[model samples]
Target: MPPTKLAFFRYLLIDEMLRSRSRPFPTKEEILEACNEKFGVNSISTIEKDMAAMRLDFDAPIYYDKRQKGYAYQDPEYKFLSVNLSEDEMLALSFVETLLGEFRNMPIFSLFSVAVDKVLDGLELTKKLHTEKRHLQQAIQIEQAPYLKGSDKLGDLLRYIAEQKVIEVSYQKYGSESTKDYLVHPYLLKEFRNMWYLIGYHEASGEVRTFGIDRITQVLPQEKDFLPQEKVNFDAESFYFYCIGVTALSEKPAEIRLRFEPFLANYVKAQPLHHTQEIIEDDEQKGCLLRLRLIINHELKMLILGYGAGVCVEAPASLAAEIRREFEKGVAQYATKN
Candidate 1:
């Protein structure tokens, strides 16, 4: 069958079951299998999405009948709305669902994918949206996407934050490999480069600190009272706003200059390393000069070094000199090895 005809046929599966002529109220799995057998839309998850869209967008009166052990219309008289779309609209909808699926992989926005599925289902478009999206995903490439770890701790931590409770956590810092316990006044959760981090006030340290969720081994909610005012106040809008990765820089942002080789200049312009980046000068012969207002931190140094010889720190002679010294030490080790 052609795309439009295939879409209409899928609608018949759910609509036929909803009408009083109902032989048996079809379970989601039944509808899902029927569509899958006829059309190639697999996955029970997709069926839930379709139902969500059906209710939210088209006001399709669908409800589950416990006695029948399957779905039924709350109002038996209701009919599925006819939604027609041009080819462009179909592709756009598919792209949106694909993008949402990407965001949903992140611990923070994980539920967003379901919302996208509902949007597609409500439009009454069938598997064609996913068919287009799948093709697009295969053709495109996403480079060096950071992998997230420590999803196990996310659920417990979220509950602790919502309950306004202090928790005793056993955390193992990166590279330490040994877990240490601390009384934490949990404030917020942050995602940096796809990794999850917990921001809280360490009761023993009397200072705010961030902990990687992956590093946490245990979190036990404590009845020990805590006040909201006591929560870590970094004063910045976002915990990681000033710094890259999960760490925050306490020092004020500075005016720093950098010069990138001509070959890398255009790429840097298109994908800025930081939000404060500004073009100080760009000339074919002179190379690309850029300025940024940011704190100088360990992470900042690492980011600069990532470009290797393609980039150089220009101003704040101190920072430039530090880079030189590190390179000299690194070179000595390699030279000795040779």
Candidate 2:
């Protein structure tokens, strides 16, 4: 007879107990207690019936040991479920594994790698395509940072965030000589462009601030608990909604219009600079006029400067003036040097 949904869960629980290192070879009484706790009051007879169904239906190698006085698996490595993937599914899995390579040295990466390996083993794909997996790694290339400083603090920061514990971080900003300490109520950790940043409510500043993890000198946990008001209730999407990159210069998003050359416009259309980007006008022979609603910040300026001569700012006179002055400065420097 096929197992019912509840019976299937009972089988899984029994299997876990049998294979568990710490609590292996669970007795009938122990199995009853565990099942009752989760599924609410199952009898010893029910467990026996479930085990019998498992052995008959799935060919489970479960047997009672007279000496051990409990049930155990004859084949220790046996699993109840067998996962089979389609050709397209395997290709997708391979691509995801390659993408995870970007986060290689980080603490989270190790955790993810172990989970992925377990999944591959469970699906029985590891043994079949071990050689192909290696080739895929070589064929698919991803940009990775040489070294990420302060990655060691990720574990501790994650713990503190979960525990709601206040922490004192010794941070040194770029171009600053001295290191300063701040009492921060860490809310979220964000990764952008291979760099990690901590978004937290600053006790002294009375506002939420972003700190570069790479610049953090030291992290010390504080005994004081995170106050209720100190919790800004941060939402990553909402916080960065109208912003570009890490910085938010203003609360409101400004209307930004730019005309891009034919070639660069195609690239911009494919890979937009911001989510708010819209194609205002598209001309095959002329160019493309794109509009974005984003806060004008340092990163935005740098991006605009990077596309020099290929892009022309149409709206926001202040932004246009700023970009023009930047180009003027660049020209003046080159002209003087020449």
Candidate 3:
């Protein structure tokens, strides 16, 4: 009457078949004995029904063999079901995987490894053709820039954060002579430009701060724990929606407008800056205009500068002023030198 017992028998039988590929065909009695031995289920009728369901609908062929007088693989060359990703999807996944590796001390690496293995297994079983050699070579040649060290401690901090445990971290603040030890309740781990950051609440200050993992000289699990006072309402995706970088936001999210050179404009259109970005106007003869709604962050500033002369930030008085200040400072430095 119970369906779980039947399903269990079916799974056992199919697994045996897959594992015993080189062995002679297994008979009904052999399957029944194996199922009973493995799962303690003696229901033969349930096994029959399970096999029928698997063979009919699940594409698992459980045909009888004449030579060995038992069941064997009907199609040994069957393929596994796998999600076929496009070039862009593959690129995005590869990028994220590489970036996430900065946290080598994290327990997340094992989980990520399992998922990646499953995906690779499915693709390996089903893939009809290998990646083109020329394309693969080109992709390999496309090198990502080198990154800073200290991934082991980063990983440990991330694991501790995921467990919601308090961690004592010895951190060296930038431009500071001394290092400080603090009990931190880590909330999130974010990656930008192959660097790792832990967003957490400090015990002493009771304020949420983002700490660079590189600057965190040491991290260890603390017996003392603290709950988030304000529930840490920040969503990384929503919080980082506006700004070009990982800079914090004081104001509400805003819509930012930018003009890109025709060459870079089309590229920007194809590969959007953010999920909320859109092309407000397109005049190829002049240039293309893009509008993005996101939190203004330090990461965004670096990204804007990355485009060099190909793109210009056109709106938001605060952002424009910041850009002007940076450029004017550079100009002043050169002028004073002359």
Question: What are the per-residue Cα lDDT tens digits for candidate 2 across 26-134?
Answer: 8999999999999874688898888999999988899999999999999886877756578888888887777777776888666787788899887778765566678
State each model's CA lDDT, in order: 0.78, 0.86, 0.69
What's each prediction's TM-score? 0.69, 0.84, 0.69
Best by TM-score: 2
C-alpha RMSD values across all candidates:
11.4, 4.3, 5.4
Per-residue alpha-carbon lDDT of candidate 3 for residues 133-160, written as tens digits (9 for 90 to 100): 3344345543353545556665677677
Error of 2 at 175 (Å): 2.1
Candidate 3 positional error at 160, Å: 3.8
**Which stretches of candidate 1 lie above 4 Å from their native place?**
1-92, 99-111, 144-147, 175-177, 224-226, 229-232, 235-238
* Model 2 lDDT, residue 304, Cα: 94
In terms of lDDT, the best-performing candidate is 2
Evaluation by lDDT, superior candidate among 2 and 3:
2
lDDT of 2: 0.86
